[model samples]
Every structure is written in C-alpha cells, then in structure tokens.
Target: MEQVLVEEYRNETLECLHRGHICGVGPDGQVKYEVGDADFVAFLRSAGKPFQAIPGVRAGIKEAYELTDQEIAIMTASHRGESFHLETLSHLMDHTGLEQSNLVCAESYPMHRGSREQIIRNQGHEQRVYHNCSGKHFGVLSYCKLMGYPLEGYEDPGHPVQQEIVETLSMMAELPADQIARGTDGCGLPVFALPLKHIARAYLKLSCPELIEDEKTREAVQKITAAMHAHPEMVSGTNRICTTLMEDTNIIAKGGFKGIYGFSLRQEQLGFAFKIVDGSDEEWAHIVVSILEQIGYANQQTIHRIRERFPSAIRNDAGKIVGHTKEVFHL
Candidate 1:
C-alpha cells in the first residue's frame, strides 16, 4: 500500500497529494524504517547505473584506458549533456578510442535546456553521445574490448558483458540471480526489478562497502563511490538532485525515470529507496527533506542546500508565489 508522502496546497487548501513507498535498510540487510509497501517491486531504471558499472571497474577499464575519476564517474552518470559533461565524455572516448557510434543508445539532443538551445541555434544534429545512457554503454563496450567479448550483442542479456553485470547486481543486492526480474530499459539495456527493500540493501552496500565479504567487490564499490564523490557534477548536471546530494560527501544517491530513486547515508549506515505511485518527480526534494527530518539526519548543510534549491514555495508562470508543498508522511 502507498502512503501520502507529500501534499500541495493552494490558497491554504490541499490541491494535490503524492502517494509513494519508502524503504530504508541497514547494513545488516534489515528494514530500519518504512512508510508504505516495502515489498513493492519496481524497475531500477537508471538507478542501476552505479551497479552496472561494477563489471567494468572489476575488469580494470580504468587502468586499461588510464581513465580519470571524472571519466569513471561518467560511466555511472545520467548526465544532462551540459558543456562540461560533453568535455569529460570527449576525454573518455579519446582515451579509450571509443566511437560514439559504438553506443547503442539512440541519438538525442542534450537534456539540458541551455545546451540543447545552444545546439539548436547552431543547427547541430543529435548524437548518440548526447544520450544520458551513453556512458553506461561506453563502459560496457570498454569492458568488452578488454575481455575479448563480442560487442555486437553486448546489450543482450545472454552476452558475456551483461552476464557479468547480472552476477554483480545479484551479489550486491544479496539476491539470487534468477530471483531478480528483468526488463529492457529505455536505453535498450537490461534493467533489474526487485522489492524496494532489496534495492535499499543494494544502496546500503554501495555506501558502506566494508560490510561486503568479497575483497574485489569491495574495492570496485570503493572506486565507483569515490569517483562519484570526486566528480559529483559528472554523475548529473547542475541543479540535479543526485549531484546536490552527493556534493555533501556523505550521501550517495541517484534517481531514475518514472519516480524511482535510491540513496544512502554513510554515517547513518542506512540506504533508502522510494517510488512515487503517480510517477511524478516534481516533489522529490520535498519527500527527501521529509525523510531526512524524520530520520534526524545530522547533515544540516545538506538539508539546507536541498531546501534552498527546491523551496516549498510554489510559483506561477510569472514567478508569483501561489502555493506550497508540505510533507505528510511520518517516516
């Protein structure tokens, strides 16, 4: 069952409410807090990028291509194709000798308004590298190049590269490989579906890798998380929640399409996954703030940043404050 996690008010009367499920898990893989159906199954979408990049890291793609942390960060990013994102991606391809054509993700203009407008002004065409998932594809392709695997069917579930990723996600989620439901992502990559609690567990392992028994997996997690920390902007563009939360250096987070989001706190030793039943992401910041407040998160600076960027005050087309949003859930 879903709970009313946020409510929007216009002229002091409730105008809209968002129902969602939130599940927080501890390092011990036990539920710490929950507000709705903890067992609700949802697709991980791009929220699986970090875990999907694990196989590449394990294959030593970083060393093989002499990739920097910024380059590595892009492999786990849903970047908006801002100028800096393009620059970093160019560097990554140059270093690895990867062609934009190698990425199977469909070509599209930059997701950032300013960047897309700039390209339109110049009459530039869409390119595959501009797709948000291109980095993940490049990471897989790089791994395939290193491992002597065929690149033609790399996106297929039965492909060797994808096989490794499945094993990695299964190990990280602490679930058997066959137990995870599978689906094709918008970018044409295989995506994982699991209960919210297991998704939280996977993020918990991501933030607190010491709990992982396997040494190699721990190292890969460390490298990936550290890359995300060192280059939060590469993980997502400016004003994105993922970059904002990770900028605090204590929170590890990523949001996916269709209102799916996952985050972890190192100090709290907790991981959380939330899904908005209506599939709206507009109130994500409000819900995140409410969660932090309920959990007594100690990072005032991080909370303040989020509130500053995404205040409760709602605005109209002319920027007039006309409404407000408030948290409705207790946990």
Candidate 2:
C-alpha cells in the first residue's frame, strides 16, 4: 500500500498532516480507484443512516406517514438540528403518533451555533429531539410502530428493526449479513463495521437503485436518494459540506462521526468512501473536494463554489490570512 496524505494544514510556518484511505467503486462492484488501504475496516456511524432507513421506507412508512421528501431526507440525516430540523422532526412524530419522549437518543444541544444560542437565550433546555440523530431515531420508531414491533428495544441488535436494517445493508453491499460487524452509535443505535469497498458498494447501489433486483429495495433506495438530493438542507444544513456538495453537483454526500465521508455520483454511477485516520472533521471537507476533483466529477464552477464556501485558510484574530490547508493526495 502506498502512503496517501489526504490533507495538510499549515499555520504560519508549520504543517500538520492527515492521512487516509479512499475507495471508489462502480455499479458493477469493481474498484475504480483507490489510495492506501481500501480494505481498512471502520464503523459507518451516521453515514449508514440512508441505508438503515431502507427497511422502514420499504415497510410503507413513507406512505403511511405521508412523509414529504424533506422529511424523508431528514430521516437519513445527521442534521445540524436547526429550528427547521426540529419542526420537521416534530411533524414527523405527530404523524407517527410518537412524542419526543419516545426517542431513545440522548439529549443534546443543537449542533448549529445559531440554534444553540437561540435556545439558550430563550432559556430552553436541550432535549432529545434536538440531538443530531433524533430524526434517525424517529424513523426507527416509525418502523417499529408500522410493524407492531416493540419500540422499547428497537436499537438492540436482536430487535427486528435492527435485524431488518442489517439485512438491508447486507443486500445493498452484496455481503453476507453474518459477515457485517456491529457496534453502538452515539445515538444508541446499531452501527455497522465493514470494509471501505463494501461501503462504497452500498453508495453505488444508492446512486443506481434500479440495479437492485428486489422491487421493494429498489423503490426504497430511489426514494431515499431523491429525498437527499431534492432537499439537501435536511440532510445536513445550509453551510455543511454534504449539503453544498449535493446542491452543487449530481452527487449525494453524507459525513459521519470519526471522519467518515461517503458520496455517490448520480451521473457516473460511482461511489466513494474514505476515512481520515485522525478523525479530524477539519480535513474532511478539503479531502472530499480533492477526491471529487481527482475523480473528474467536479466542474470548475463547482470547485469555485466549494472553495468559496469552505475555505480552509487560516486567519489571524483580525481575520488576516496567515496560512491555509491544501490537498496533498494524488487520487
């Protein structure tokens, strides 16, 4: 394996390095490009939400709850917990006959700075509903309600909802269910561990769901991908890399905890997944842009927008430019 320095951070006169592995796969499950150890195993974290939501969508939760595309997008989100996000979650819970109390995720303040400040100014305490993973938990609850399964332990590996999620992920990844490892997420849901290539394969299926043989799975993937693209804001937020990337190009992207980022290119039917070994979110946006450029998917306009919106330049207290972050990877 070759050394892949994904990003470099410079401050005045010193540089810090971030290294990682990246893998790109086509619809046929063939590795199209790779850097470093493409087989490196890691937890998917929230990057798996879109796939995890497949079972619920296939179970008719979308039709039953009359979920809008924006709402469906939130279901697959690691949102910024903006006011709009909370309102959307509230509406989804209302349709499902659930309440904030029903959510199993731990309480947390909003991830968006403005939302957090507003809540504090209003003397409103943090609630489970404001947690970034609340939408995902709500989707799990909806699945439990639709199937009449016990919602109390829905996050348990033995639970039917979790079992179905695993099965759905397995089908999409073209891997055996038993081969997929499991772990607990920050939101107390079951997260998956697999090779980078398998994760890329899942995203490839998401981009080209028509390639799936099962009618229900295909329909679910199509709906989820459409929702993410149509309402990118619900997937992340106004200033997030995921939202900006999807909005600017024909790619559906998502970022997860521990520096996991994945995206699928709709026009090319390709999927990419990568991990920053140091788990630094700061390098993620830069690496994503670099990967898109390397794969020949980003246009000049898209590159300009990304640079304008996600500048990695270091600035002094007076906002003077001191140094910058740059991509160092060849592919």
Angstrom error of the Cα, residue 46, model 2: value is 0.6
Winning candidate number (lDDT): 1
Model number with the top TM-score? 1
Question: RMSD of model 1, in Å?
Answer: 0.9
TM-score per prediction, in order, is 0.98, 0.96
Per-residue lDDT of 74-132 in model 1, one digit per residue for the tens?
99999999999999899999988889978889999999999999999999999999999
Displacement of the residue 316 alpha carbon in candidate 1, Å: 1.3
Residue pairs in collision within model 1: none
Quote model 2's TM-score.
0.96
C-alpha RMSD values across all candidates: 0.9, 1.5
Q: Give the Cα error of residue 97 in candidate 1, in Å.
A: 1.1
- Residue pairs of candidate 2 with colliding backbone atoms: none
Q: What is candidate 1's TM-score against the reference?
A: 0.98
Please write out the lDDT profile of model 2 over residues 1-331, one tens digit for every residue: 5354543445645467777888999878889888887798878999999988899999899999898888899999998888788888878987888888888898889999999999999999989999999889888889999999998988899999999899999988888999999899999999999989999998888877777999989998889888988888999988788888878547778889998888888778898889888777777778877877877764677777788888878777998887888778876
